[model samples]
Target: MTVTRPPDVSVVVAVHDTMPYLTACLRSLVDQTIGAGRFEVIAVDDGSTDGGGAELDRFAAEHPGLFTVVHQPHSGGPAVPSNRGLDLATGRYVFFLGADDLLAPHALERLVDAADHYGSDVVLGKMVGINGRYVRQDVYARTDPDLDLYGSALPYAMSNTKLFRRRLLDRYRLRFPVDMPVGSDQPFTIEACVRAERISVLADAVYYYAVRRHDRGNITYRSSPAQRLDTARRLIEFTAGLLPAGARRDAVLARHFDWELSKLVGKDFARFDPETRSAVCAAVKSLSAAYLTGRILDRLSPAQRYRLALAARGRIDLLIQPALHSGSAPLVLEKERVLVHLPGFDEMEREHFVFNGAFDSRMASGIRVLEAAWSSDRLVLWIRAPVLGDGAAEPAPLGISGVPAEVTTELAVDGSGTTLCARIPMRALLGGRRHDIRLAVTAAGELYEFPLPALGRRLRQRRWHRGRPYRISVIPGRDEQMVVRVSRVPWRRALLWRKQ
Candidate 1:
């Protein structure tokens, strides 16, 4: 394709041997809701052996004015290809798209509109996952005209698949790290977010990040933990150099601890080889001890906080216990304390541990459920509420929807607050079908709702017992008590089951 004039946006695609999915990805860009004259595609074929170069050539020939293909020797990573595409980009704004991913029809139009309207140096479009769970739409729940990378939730949207003003990149001379094989885009994205004068988020615009269900070719999915951790260390050092030591820096690093670093202390930790385990443990311990402060650690979930604490202490062996449980362990609440009962662990092990109780500021005034457990016949909830003055309070009647059920409530006063234990019949609530039972307490002619913690979904681990064939999940709901989803096992084998 002959380049005549600069376009509004340049779509930079770095392709390797992604022939199977490249056609759909290129097609999505060509069929953009934005007019053809407004955008151009600059695709770099990084030494494709599987005829992907030919595919790009065909596309270029078909749309000479809109598509341009650059052929380069394999650099073993996207960094070189992306850098080449950047050099050849002749657009006011640059948007990077993966060769295996597609964009929503109006992605470029919305991003350009938002960038122009807000005069933003960087504009982020929402990313939706296809055939995988990589998408975090919550990060882009609202549109921000001027987002602070450190202060706002924009740091969570730190993928290179965003629109950047061409002048900003040229001024900063920003390019991806060519040496790093994995997580190469992170440093580039981080630096861009830090240097940009104004960044806007267009939550309505979507970029479909495709994950191949079979034979995924992304380097990240195939890289070893040691390899990935090396890049992680580099990224951490790079990020530290950008920001001063304070809440902002801690917040940015906190994401790494919560998501990436936490994997070392997850269920798969025990499965690693001795060398891999030792290396991972050492790296995680060092990273956690250096950056994971109480201020930042307090913001994570109970499970995460516990794991990080163990990591910081360098108790890799002890970390394995909680990791093995996989969040199925029932939480026990006593007075002001929250305890996790690990399977096969001694009572001393269970009693010695205490999790962070300050989930949110609302827990100070209203009632909060610290832990919940389910049995064949009953559902037990451990709750903490404000203490009554005289130590004498009327029992509040608990309500269970979907079927007739018996509710029993017991209250005890302690040094911290009033502890309420409620037991409800599970059979009546479930009724052999999936049900979201809402529990409420009626006192003084008013209904008081109990807010439960939002434990994210997990289909990978079988939390429910074998032969039971019924799984119950607790999701945070708009109303009281939380929403409970019960589902029968669709097959004899689990969803994520593999042959041992």
Candidate 2:
């Protein structure tokens, strides 16, 4: 009798018209350093019209006993195909990979090794965004052997891209919510993490999420505001039902409020049609009434809380005031209170709209880093900030350790704003550490710290310092903050580089 052992991992890819990107994704999977015997790829082509099914077949035919290609009619979303693939998985651990995304060469091996070594039922590999996609990264700051799902930043990154033990999943009968057009993976991943005995996170670059420059067929891109709101509401309801109402539940629900709910009231909210806007307001009001706990509200920034409160009260007119104020709303300072001057807010209602804390960076304007570059071994940031009365106050670098703010030049000054040049020596960022850059200034006697927004995707610099080489890059965070990562390069790899 012959015995066949299950593969170490089963990668489930739900595909739909991914075309050129699909080829790269499949190729990355087959070329994994873990070897074909260690992992199997189960691809479900969800009624792709764009030859994606043919591409999958070609790969399967070329690599026998490696790929399992399944074809099914379009089920309107990825949940159907992902569930089917999960049901067919025969490996000890299952990983859900996006058809439009690919993995690092050694991602599977590292994930499997970490999972086995830590005896974890779930493992999350560090994911980087390519082609301008923003993936939340706070959870991947370090390699944690045992991560707390509710106590940590895991809630912010509840995508189904992580590895899960098949046994744990089957034990709980976990599956994606098929009824959701978008964000179905959140519920599936959240439940798996909650049920798993232990969860691990790997800091190594494991997944590359690509955002197609011109592909609107992506489900998230195609989903309407209403559809996304409905999905968010459903997710909130699911989360509320999964856990008892308290700090633990509030910790999880905070993600939905900050992202899904707050996103609905962004600058674009003003552009939504009247009916759609009204519907969004009504839905937000209902959700807030049902769930929005004080703990969750406290977790939100004052700006976010105010915006959601207005939306919940069906104050679409007041909600649109911030967007129409040219991003710098009128500020009133009475003693320690900083109140926002919004139209139609009476004296009684005006107090409710006051900034929760002494600082509200959201209402501050012109704190953007228009350009970042290297000059004379120094990192230069051209910052735009509002000019206070008498043009006295200037934006200063804050929170960065051992680095002093050097405003070399006041580039320009106008009634709208002032552009200042801030320079920091690269040496200040050595020691293989990361630093978050924030620009602080005073407006209307109120101090605000704003995250520096980079104009481009990411910026990088390579240099050899103190007989060791380092790679410095400015990464744009998912929450619009900019991060500076300074990493030491291996000697062997550093030697291979051409001399500058």
Candidate 3:
């Protein structure tokens, strides 16, 4: 009798009617630098009517030992197919790959190596959106060999596309929830991250998540508002059930609140009909009443918190007014409350419509950087913001953080509301890494953060100190924000620049 050794990694692909894309996906698997002997491909063909099943069979026949093709009746959701593949995974590590997505040639090799090197039960290699698809980049800002799920931005990046240890899954019986037709990946990924002894994040781009230009039939695209709302509610309940009530739990729940809950009341929400709108508001109220802790609510932005608060209080009409008003609603300051003038809502209950909370009377809707320039090797930003307090205002302080450090400056008044002149020493950004700049102001005991628009010039500068060259550039970032990148100029590049 001959014994076959278990593969080091198993790539579980749940296939639907993804044909041409599936071919590319399988090819990527075949070309993996991890070698076919080290990793096996389990392609679960869930009744792929578009000849995808036949393609999978052909690939299995050609690849033989490297591929395993399983056919099952059409499952309405990917969860069933995913669970089927997980049940048959026989490897030290298991990675879930989307049927329509492509992996880099060295993806599995790097993921497996990182997992082994760090003893990580879950290893997330950086993934990017391809073909106009949007993937959140917050968690991929940098690599952390051992990431803290609750302390970091991992909560927002919970997708089941990464590598998971087989033993850990077996130990906890972790599997996708079959009932969740959409968004089931989040629950499975979140639970695995919670139970894993160590979770790692690699900065290398290893996966390409594509949004087929011709086919937007994926569950996420096909899912209705009601379906999304239900899934969000279930996710909130599930996350709340997993961790105890505390800051850690709040951190995880905050993602759901911001992405899921707040999304329910976003711009397109106003387009929903009366019945659908009512249903969404009711669901929001239920979830908020059940799991929205004060800490979690505080974690939300002022706009998000206000929209959700209106929804929770069954003021759908009031919630819809913001969209109708185009945010041109009048702001009335009564004592310490700055309220957006909306009809049918009591001004006294300022908690529901106010920008922040009680005793808060300001908004950053008008805040912007009037000028950004280098003043003697120091980056200076002149910002105009809303004026709140009187001459005795003290105006609070303004700050921006990126490399574990914050540069703060006092807000000054100059005939135009309030202004801030922040002088950031170039030396503070000397490290050879990208720094994500975030700006926030503390006024009236409430903190309001705003995005700095692209300064348009691609502000680039370089300085030579002690014979070593350093370069710094501030440019537009995702979502109209700005980022600062600093690096040490290589000798070759410096010489090239000198010649230029």
Give the clashing residue pairs of candidate 2, or none: none
Pairs in steric clash, model 1: none
In candidate 2, residue 7 scores what lDDT? Answer: 99
Each candidate: RMSD: 14.7, 16.3, 15.0
35-139: candidate 3 lDDT, tens digit per residue: 889999998999889999999999999998999999999888899999998999999999999898888998999999999999999998888877767788888
List candidate 1 stretches off by more than 4 Å.
Answer: 1-4, 205-209, 328-333, 342-500
Could you give candidate 2's per-residue lDDT for residues 1-500 as a string of tens digits?
Answer: 99999999999999998988899999889889998898999999999999999999999999999999999999989999999999999999999988988888888888889899999999999888776677888998998999998889999998899899999999999999899879999999888887888999988565545555365566767788889779888889999999889898899999999998888876768878898889889888899999998889878876777778778778888767644335454344444455554444342354345655434445344456778898888888877654322312332223222355576434244433456676888878775488877776554555566677655778899888898889999887757678888998998889888653
Better candidate number, 1 or 3, judged by TM-score: 3
Per-residue lDDT of candidate 1, residues 1-500 (tens digit): 99567799999999998878899999998889899999999999999998999999999999888999999999989999999999999999999999988888888988888899999999887777777747777668887898888777766667798999999899999999999888888888888888888988877556556555357667767887787668767777777788888888877877777666776567767777778777777887777666767666665676666565555556667756643455433333434444544432342344334444442232324455667766546766666554321212333334444445555454443333345565756554445444444345433334434445443442111234444555655666554436666676666555544343
lDDT of each: 0.70, 0.79, 0.79
Q: State model 2's lDDT.
A: 0.79
Clashing pairs in 3: none
Cα displacement (angstroms), candidate 3, residue 14, comes to: 0.7
RMSD of 1: 14.7
Worst 10 residues of 3 by lDDT: 387-396
Model 3 TM-score, all chains together: 0.70
